[model samples]
Target chain A: MSDKKTITFPVEATHVMMFRRSIGDYAVPDTGLEKAAVPPTFPRAVAQFDPDYHLRLKPGEAWFGSGKKPSGVEGKPSSAGGLHAEQHFEFLRPMVPGDVLSVTEHVGKTWEKESKRAGKLVFTERVQEFRDQKGELVCISRGVSVRTERPVDQK
Target chain B: MRLKASQISVGDTFEDILVEDLKRTQLVMYSGTSGDYNPLHTDDIYCREAAGYPGVFAHGMLTMGMTGRVVTDRFGAENVKKYGVRFTNQVWPGDDLKGKAVVDAIRQENGETLIDMTITTTNQKGDVVLSGYATARAEK
Candidate 1:
């Protein structure tokens, strides 16, 4: 828990716009999108999380485990920093194209634990909030990331 | 059966999202719907011992679906702009889950209105089981 940080970044309407465009690609009966007569929108409320939004990172940022690859097991290590999870939103009140959407992020907590394969595991939680043109809370998001050490059995 | 968004005001709350009982049928259907097949939600014996439950519990999504029913009731499906939520806690079977949403904020532009909601789900014990925010287009 000692290595915790807090950071914030402003996300705009375009961020929301991108998520709406891509979420459908992930849609399948598995996530419950099968029976719809037409593909549903990501809902304007969740437009802020385009996932494609270039992750705003700070200097000296180090990632741990390899991340997910578009293809398979040979892809990037996902948890070098940690396994990332997110919650997204589309503002009921538009963030509008030019509005300064303040995104405040904080590395609230981090912890480590033993792992059967990787030997050790570290996890981090990041919280982000976006505010709209009126200085009102537009969206709140939490990201959880997990990283694991190399397998003890590895050569 | 339904309440128009205009009929509600800031601080006003709606009736509970009623379900007779958290039957296995609903949970099974929900697992199929949500793709969350955690054994704790389906296997009664495993839930009672490993998960420390009296019996199987309802999927958080089922409770969320109940909450969505509230949104569908208030704004109808067409006007709902977004519906996203986190599963804050759990709801077990036989729990009387009630959902209520209060208008927390509102904005208008070009005659279009969007309302923010502080939506909550609670058991009969009045303990909040799930909590999240929702936004919808206000009817003209």
Candidate 2:
């Protein structure tokens, strides 16, 4: 649990509802917020609270998605922000809507390997701890992102 | 409904079709909800010209999120204590996905019953896209 940065995430009911739909889980009703059963991977939604998160669009900054040209940024980014390699979650207790979480992220591990499909691969692990308002750990998320020397061979 | 230790066995398996003919709009929906605006998942032109991919691909987290239902449905989300996965292959726009969760072990810890399971998600061609494991509480 190396110290790094923290952000506050307010778990809202409507947002949870939307996330459920995004993942195609329709069996559970979105009406009951208090007793609503949240999905196990909901913690990753913490990205919303991270103001400087690289993937989201900022108000005035040039976005990398698309516009008149293939990209809005001044120059090519060489590669995409890498690919997701692994993700894991550990829950100490069920995290429900209405619980404000204080989320913190720390750099975990980094390594490199040679790959035939994508050339050289550099992997970095980011660990996040979600804590309730009471300062109790609600969940722990570990994610690994990888950057390849070149685009993966489609064949 | 929570899995019952009395009713389930180590080899018992559960499966679900996570998605069929996956649409680009589905990828956009995931990007919107997940706050991940990575063009590799939604922007065709950017991916083709810049990233060098054929086109957009699904976020690994999106696939992980969908694969989770196979486990959560059986044990209930609240009962799950651990869930994790590795992205084995990329998922494309028109690909169909199916996920399976197989019970691997059941044990008693501190008088509480728990089940460990192995997870696998495969595309239409039988290529494994995601693989991982989960542990959840069971009714004693």
Candidate with the greatest lDDT versus the true structure: 2
> Candidate 2 at residue A120, lDDT?
91
Q: Using TM-score as the measure, which candidate wins?
A: 2
User: Individual DockQ of the candidates?
Assistant: 0.06, 0.84
Q: What share of the true interface contacts does each candidate keep?
A: 0.05, 0.87
TM-score of 2: 0.95
**lDDT, residue B18, model 2:** 96
Residue A16, model 1: lDDT of: 29
Q: Mind giving the per-residue lDDT tens digits that candidate 1 earns over B69-102?
A: 5665566544655555655455776767777887
On the 0 to 100 scale, the lDDT of residue A3 in model 1 is 21
Q: What TM-score would every model get versus the actual structure?
A: 0.50, 0.95
Q: DockQ for model 2?
A: 0.84
